[model samples]
Target: MDAMAAIKQTFFQECEEQLAELEIGLLAIQDGDVNPETVNAVFRAVHSIKGGAGAFSLDDLVHFAHVFETAMDHLRAGRLAPSHEVLKTMLRAMDVLADFVRAARDGGCVDAERSQTLAKELRALDPDGSGAGSEMDDEEIAFEPVLMDQSMFDDELEAAAAPPVRLFTIRFRPKATLYAKANETALLLREIGLLGEMAIACDASALPLLSELDPEGGYLSWTIELLTTQDEAAIREVFEFVEWDCDLDIESDAASAAPDDIDLAALIQKMQATVEAELSALSPPPTRVDPLAEASRKDADASADPGVIDLAKARQKKSEQAVGEHLGPKPDQGAAGGASQPTIRVDLDRVDRLINLVGELVINQAMLAQRVMEAGLARASGVATGLDELEQLTREIQDSVMAIRAQPVKSVFQRMPRLVREVAAMTGKLVRLVTEGENTEVDKTVIERLADPLTHMIRNAIDHGLESPEARAAAGKPEEGLVHLSALHRSGRIVIEVSDDGAGINRARVKEIAASKGLIAADASLSDEEIDNLIFLPGFSTAPSISDISGRGVGMDVVRRSIQALGGRISITSRPGRGSTFTMSLPLTLAVLDGMVVTVAGQTLVVPLTAIVETLQPKIADVHGFGGGARVIAIREHFTPLIDVGRELDYRGENADPLACVALLVESEGGVRSALLVDAILGQRQVVIKSLEANYRHVPGIAAATILGDGRVALILDVDAVVASSRADSAAFEQSLATAG
Candidate 1:
C-alpha cells in the first residue's frame, strides 16, 4: 500500500490499544476507583483518537469524539460526579465512540442518530448548563441545536436551534512537548474558530534568532477571544490530552461573570494553589504550570531594542520554566513512557510459518537420533551425546516459537461483558457477568476460534441454564442472576468454564426434549449427566417458543463441534437447584503433544499421555464380562469399563484375550474411567501434531497423526471417542441378539 495508507493503518492499530485502555479505565471507575490518573488516561485515549482522526480527515470520528471527550473532561476536572447514572452514560458513549472510530477506519457508514443521541446525553451531563442559577459568577451554557444536513450528524437533534452567543477569552500556550506529541496548534485554533468568532494573538518575544533558537523549543503562546453559544466545558475540552503538556487557561469575559470582584481565572488559581499545596503535602509533587494572566497578555515589549531583546536569556529561562510538564514517563513505568516493555507486532502468518519450521526441525531431530541408534553408536558416544543435545535444543526452540504465539485470553474475555449486556437486554433478565483468570494465556489461534463457542455457551447458560427471576426467587436465589466465566491452566491445558448461579439444567426437561426430537428413546432410562449432555444433540433445544435469542436449536451443537475442531472437549455438570457449569478443556498448543506410543492390532498408534492414568497387565480375575461383548476391569478398588482398542477401531472384530493384551487406565473429559486394551506399550515422546483431516479425510476413532522417530506414521487415538463408541456398539449388539432370539 501507499505510505499514507500504511500510516493510517498504524494509527488504527494504535486506536485499538487506546480503546482497550479507555474501556479498562472506565470499568475501574465504575468499580469505584478514584485515581486521578485513571480519569486522565481515559481522557487522553479519546483526545489522542480525536487528534489523529483530524489528520486523516475522519470528520465523523472527530465530531463524535469531540462531544464524548467533553463529558469525560467534566469528570476529569471534578465538575461532573462519577455517579452510577453519569458513568453509565459515559460507558455507552465510549462504545459509540469506538464504533465511530472503527467505521472511520474501515470505510463503513456510522449510525448518526445513535451518535447524535449519545452526544446529547453527554452534553446534558457536562454540568455546564443543566443546573439552575447558582451563586457562581460564571454560568453554564447550552446550545440550541442548529439544523444540519444528514451527512455530518443527524438532523434530528435533541434541542432547538442556536439562539445567542457568549464571549469568552481562551488562553493557550504551546510547550515543546505539545509539538513533540504531534499536536498542531493551528488545528486547535481552526476547530475552535469553527465554534465561534475568534481572534488569535501570538506572543513571539520568547523566540530567539536563527543563531540561538532551538527549533523544537516552546516559544509561542496565544490569547483567543471566542464568541459562541457553546459552554465553557466544551472550550476547555479542546486541550484535554495536552493539558498537562501545555499551559491552558479559560475564563468568562462577560459582565454576567460570577457577581465577584475577582475574575474566574484568578479565583480558580487561588483555589487550585491551596488545593495543590495540601495535595502535595500528602502525595507527590505537582506537575508544571504557567502564570495564566501573564501568558494571556497581548502586549510583549513594544519598546525593545531592535538588536537583541532585553533579558533574552531571562525570558528564555522563564518561558522554559513556564512551559508545562514534559512528555513524562507512564505512571506505572519510569518518567518516560517510551521505555514501556518493548514489543513488536508480528504478522500471524509469520508466526505460523515459524511454528511449521520448528515442527519440521523436531521431526528431523528425531530422525537423526533414530539413525544414530541404528548405527550402533554407544549411548555415551560423542555422536549420541550430540544427538541428545540436538533433541534438547530442538525442543527448546519449539517451545520458544510457541511462546511467541501465546497470548492472554483477556481479548476474548473483554468481549464477554458486551455479550452479556446484549443477551440480558434481549431476555429482559438482569445478569451480572463476573469473570476471573482472564489473564490465562493460550495459543493465539485457539483464542480466536474459541470466541464463538464461548459466546454461544454463555448465551446457553443464561437462557437455558439460568432460571427466570420469579423462579429463582422461589428457589431461594438472588433476584438478579449471575453468569460467571473463568479460565486457567490445568495439567498443561487451558480449562475455561462458563457457569451460572441460577437454576441448574433440568434433566427431565432435557430428556423429554431429546426424546421428542427422536434423539433418544422415549422411555429410555438415562443418567443425569447423560441427560445434561443431550442438549448438545443437534436440533435439540428446550425453549418453549422460537425467538430471536435462542429457540431454534442451533447453538449447543455448533459449540461442541467448534470445540472439537480445536482439539478440545466440552462437558457439563449440574446440580438440581443450585447451578450448572460447562467446562471446556483445550490444549495449550496444537502443534505438538506428549503422547504414549503403543502397538494396537499390529499398528503403531499414539495415545495422549494426558488422558492416561496408568498402564497394567489385567489379571484374569479382575476382568469380568458385562453385557453382550462389553467387559469391566477392576483397578485400585474401582471397577472401570474396559474397551479393546483394536476392536473399537475395527482392526479385528473379535475381542482380544485379556491375558494377551495390556489395559491402559484412562479418563475421559467427563472424568469417566475406562481401561483401553491394546497390544504392547512402546514409549512416551513428544510428537509434532500433523492434521489427519487436512492431509487425508478425518478418521472417526483417530484424532490426528504424527511421525515416529523411525519414520513410521502413527494415528493418534481419540480416546474419548473410542471409549464412547464401545458402549453404543455393545448396547446395539445386545438389543439385536435379544430380538433375534
Candidate 2:
C-alpha cells in the first residue's frame, strides 16, 4: 500500500473506535445515565470523526458528521431535551453517520436522499439558529467568540482586527480516576499546547517520600501560561473528555493584561525558579521523556512554536519527568492487573495461521503417540513418558492459540439495537430491546456467523412472536413489546438467547400453517413443543400475507440451517400469553472436538461427546421392532429410537444386531433422544477437525472429519442429521406399506 493509503487505513480504524464510543454513550444516555461526561464523550466522538474526515477531504462524511455533531451539541449543552422521540432520531442519525463513514472508507456512496433527510431532522433538533441559546447559557454553554462571515469581515483590513491575543494561567489537577480511564495528562497538555504557545510548570510539592507514596495516587499538578487568540470555550474544549475526572480552572488574564503588554518571558523565569526550588526541597521526580514534546514534534504542524516558546530552552533541556507519567509502574493496569498487559493489533490472518499450525501439532503428537504404542513401548518407558508430556504440552499450546481467536460477543450484540429500531418502525410496534452478558467470549468464527441467524431470530420474535400494541393492551400487557438478548458460557459452549415478552408462539396458527402448506399430516397428533417446531419446516409461514419483514417461508428454517452449520443447535420454548425464547447452544470453537471414536460396519466413526447422554450395551430383549422395520430401545422408563449407524450411513443394507452392538444414547437438536448402534466403542480423544465440505463435499450424515491417533481419518457424526434422516426414511417407508395394504 502507498503511504497515503496506509494513513487512511489508520484513520478509518480510529473512526471505528470513535463510532463505538458514540454508540455506547448514546445508549447510556438512553438508559437514563445523563452524566455530563457521557454527553461530552459522545460529542467528542463525533467531533473527532469529523476532524479526520476533513483531513481526508471526505466531503460527504464531514458534512453528515457535522450535522449530527451539531444536534448532539444541543443535547450536550442542555438546549435539547433527551425525550424518547428525540433520542430515537439521534440514534437513527448515528446509524446514517456510520454508513457515511463506511462509504467514505470503501469508496462507495450512501443514499443521498436518506442522508439529506436525516441531516434536516438533525438540524431541526437545535432550538435556536445560533448555538448560544438561553436556558443552558450559565451551566452548560460557556462563552465562545463568534466570528462574522460578512463580506466586510472577510476583507483583509477587517481580518487584521481579529480577536486579540490574551494571556491565560490554567491550573490542571487530574484525579486518579482520570488515569484509570486511560486519559493521559500528556495528551491533554498537548492539546492545550496546540491552541497556542505555552509554558508548563510541574508542581511536585505534594509528592510524598518514596516509601510513603501510593503508585497509583495523583500527587502532581501543572500550571501553564498560554498566549493565544482563541476564546475560553476553545480552551475548555481541550479538557472536555476529562472535565469530570479532574479539577481544572482556566483563568483568563484578559481582564488584567493583553498578550503584548504582559511579560510572559519574565513570568516563565519565575515559574521555572519555583519549580527548581520545589524539586530541590522534595525528592527529585522520576526521569522520563516528554511525551507531549515528542508528539508535537511528530505532528505535521510541528514547525510552528507550540510549547515553552518564550521560556528559556535550558529549562526544557533538563530531563524533567513527564507530569502525565505518574509514579505507577503501569498506569493503565486494571484492578486485577490483567488490563495492564500491553496489546497490539495483529492481523486476524496471522492468528488463524497460528491456530492451523497448532492443529497440525496436535495431529502430529497424536500420530507419534499411536506409533509408540503400536511399537510395543511400555507405558512406563522413558520415551512413552516423554510422549505423554509432549501430548499434554501440545494440548496446552492448542488451547492458548484458540484463546487468541476468542472474542467477546459484544461486537455482534452492539449491532442489534439498530436492527430492532428499523424493524419496529416498519412493523408499527413499540419495542424495547434489553441485552445482557454481552461479554461472553466465543470463537471469532462462530461470532461472525452468529449475526445472521441471530438477526433472523430477533426479527421473527418481533414479527411473529410479539403482538401489536393494541393487542398487547387488550391482553392487559404493556403497550410496548420487550425483546431480550443474552449470552453465556454453558458446558464448554456458548449459549445465546433471544426472547420476547409478547404473545409467544401461536401453536394453533403454526399447526394450521403447517397443514395448509402440506408440511405435516393434517390429522397428525403433536405435542405443544412439536407444534412450535413446525415453524422450522421449509415453506412454513404464519404470516397472513407476504411482506418484506418475513413470510416467504424462509426465516426460521434458515436460522436452523445456519445454526447447524456452525455445529450449533437451536430450540424454542414459548408460554402462551407470556413470551417466547429461542435458545442457541454453539461450540466454543470449531478447530477441535471431543468425541468417542467408534467402529461401525468395519468403518471408524466419531461421535461428539456433547451429544452423548450415556452409553449402554444393548440387550436384544429391550429392542422392540415397529412397523416399517424401525426399532426403539427402552431405557429406564422412556423409549428412544434405535438407529443403526451402519444402515443410516449405507455402510450395510441391514440393521446391526442389538445384542452385539453398543448403543450410544444421544440427544438431537430438537431434544429428541436416539440410541445410535455401533459395532464397538473406541477410547475418547480430542481430535483436530478438518472441514469435510470444504475439502471434499457436503455429506448428509457427517459433520466434519478428524485425524485419529492411529493416523486414519474418521467421520465426525452429525447425530442430529442422522436421526432426522432416519426418521424421514422410516416415515416414508410406513406410508408406502400403508398404501400397499
Candidate 3:
C-alpha cells in the first residue's frame, strides 16, 4: 500500500474503536449513569473521529460527527438532560455517524437525506448553536493571569474589555511510534495553527549525517511560537492524544507574548521562512486523492480492500446479516494513542493457520505416545517418561494457541443493541435491552457465527417474546418491555441466554397453533418439555400474519440448526404470563478437548469430560422401571433418567439393561441430568476435534469426530442431544404403558 492508503487504513481502524466508545458511553448515559468521566469519554470519542475525518478530508463524516459531538457536549457539560426524547435523538444520530464512517471506510453510499435529517435534529438539540466550541472536552481549562495594558483598563470605562492573548511556547518532539500510529506532524501543526498565530522552527541539531540517520527515526523536533486568545488548556488540547506518549512540553512564553519583543519577532520571522522553504523542497501531494471520495465512490475499482469495509462483504456472505451489521463500532481500542495491552491486530488466517498446526502436533504427540505404549516401554522407562513430559508440553502449547483465538463475546453483543432498537421501533413497542457477561470469552469463530442466531433470537424476544405496551400495562407490568441478554461460561461451554420479561409463551396457544398447522396430532398428549421443544420444529409459526418480523416460522428452526452446527444446543424455558428464556450452549473452542473414551456396543466413542458429572455402576436395587422400556436411576436422592447410549445412537438394535451397564451420569445445558449407559470406560485423554460436518455431514447424536490414540476415529457424543432423545423415548414409553394398562 502507498503512504496515504496505509494512513487511511489506520484512521478507519481507529474509527471502529471510537465508534464503539461513542455508542457505549451514550448507552451508559441513557441508562442513568451519572459519571462525569463517562460523559467526557463520549465527547472524546466523537471528537477524535471528527479530528481524524478532517485529516482524511472525509467531509461528510466530519460534518455529521461535528453536530453529533455537539449534542454529546451538552450531556458532558450537564447542559442537557438525558431525557428519553433527547437520548433517542442522540442515539439515532450515533447511527448516522456510524453510517458516515462505514461509508467512508468501505466505499459505500449513505442516504444523504437521512444524514441531513439527523444533522438537523442534532443541531436542534443545541439551540444556542455554539457546538464547535464544545470540542475542547479534554482541555484542562485554567484562566491564568494575563497582562492587561493600561489602555484596556481605560477601555473598560469607555468600551468593553477584550479577552487577553496568551503566548504559549510549545516544544514538540515526535517519537517514531507517532509516525507508526499514522499521526502526521504536519496535521498536528495545522490543528495548532487553527487556534492562533503560530510560527514553527525545526530543530535539526540532533539529526545525524545522512548515512547515520535512520529513516524511521524521529531525529528532529520543533519549537512553536503561538499567540492566541485561547488558554494554555486549549493549546495543550491539541496534543491530548499524545500527551504522555511523546516528548511534549508547553508553557507560557511571556517575553515572546509581548507585542514589542522585536528580537523574538525577528527570530520567528526567520524560522517561518526557513520552515516554508524546507517544506516546499518536498514533493507535492496529489490534488484529487480524497479519503472521503475514495470510500464511497461507486465508480471505484474492486481493489477497494475488503479489510477496509467488511460490512459489504458480510452482506454478500451471510443472508442473515441484519440491519445491525456494521452499525455499532468496536470497543475502545485502548488508551488515547497508546495501546494499554501492547496488542497487535493479526489476520484471522494467520491465527487459523497456527490453530491447524497445533492440531497436527496434538495428533502427532498422541501417535508417539501410542507407539511407546505398544513397544512395551516400562512405566518408569526414560522413553516413557520423556514422552509423558513431551505430551504435557504439547498440551500447554496447544492451550496457549487456542487462547490466542479467545475473544470476548462483547464483539457480537455490541451489535445487538442496535438490532433491538431497530426491531422495537419497527414494531412500535417500547423495549429495553439489559446485557450481562459481555466480557465472557469465547472462540472468535463461535462469536462470529453467533451473530445471526443471536440477531434472530433478540428479534424474536422483542417481537414474539415481548408483549406490547398496552398488553404489558394490562398485565400489571411496566409499559416498557425488557429483553435481557447474558453470556457466561457454564460447564466448559459458553452459554448465551436471551430472555424477555413479557407474557411467556402461551402453552395452549402454542399447541393449538402447532395443531392448526398440522405440525402435531390434535389429540397428542405432550409433556411441558415437549411443548417447549415444538418451537424448534421447522415451519412452526404462531403469528397470525407475516410482518417484517417473525411470522414466517423460519427463525427458531434456523436458530436450532445453527447452534447445532456449532456443536452446540439451544433450549427454551418459559413460564405462562411471566417470561421465557432461550439458552444456547456452545463449546469454548472447536479445536481440541479433554474427553473420556468409552465403548458402546463394541464401538468406541468420546464423551466430553466437561459433560460428565460422574460415573456409576448401576445397581439393580437403585434402578426402577418407569414404563414399557425407560427407567430412572436413583443417585443421591435424585432420580436421573437413563439413556442407553447404544440404543440412542442406534449402534445396538436392542436397548441395554441399566443394571448390566455402567452409567455415565451427565447434565444437559438446562440442568437436565441423565445416565448414559456405556459398556465400559476407557482412559481419559486430550483429543483434537475434527468436524464431521466439514468432512462429511452433521450426525444427529454425534457432535464431531476425533482420532483416538489407538489411531481409530471415535465419534464425540452430543450430550445434550442424547439427553433430549431420552426425554422423547420416556414420553413414548409412558404412552405405551398407559395403552397396555
| Highest-scoring model, lDDT | 2
Residue 316 miss distance in model 1 (angstroms): 22
User: Candidate 1: how large is its RMSD?
Assistant: 11.3
TM-score of each: 0.73, 0.82, 0.77
TM-score of 2: 0.82
Cα lDDT tens digits, model 2, 19-64, are 8888888888988998999998999899989988888999879878
TM-score of 3: 0.77
lDDT score of residue 81 within candidate 3: 81
On residues 1-741, what C-alpha lDDT tens digit does candidate 1 reach at each position?
Answer: 599988998899999889888988988998899999999999989989999999899987887787788788899999989998898788788888878878888778878787777777777785778522221212357769887666544443423343346667788888777766667777787788788666555455454332233445567776676667788888877776678778988987555322233354554454345433432333211463233323423122223222222333434544454443542222454322232244677878999999999988888887888888789989999998888898889888888889999999998988777677678878878777888998899999899999899999888888877777888788888878988899998767899999998678878888888888899989776677778889898999889999877889998999999988878889988898888999999989989988998998899999999899899998989999987878999887888998999988989979999899989998887678889999999888889998898899878889899988899999999988898798778767866776678
Q: By TM-score, is 1 or 3 better?
A: 3
**How well does candidate 1 score on lDDT at residue 327?**
26
Candidate lDDT values, in order: 0.79, 0.82, 0.81
**Each model's total of backbone clashes:** 5, 0, 1
- Backbone clash tally (model 2): 0
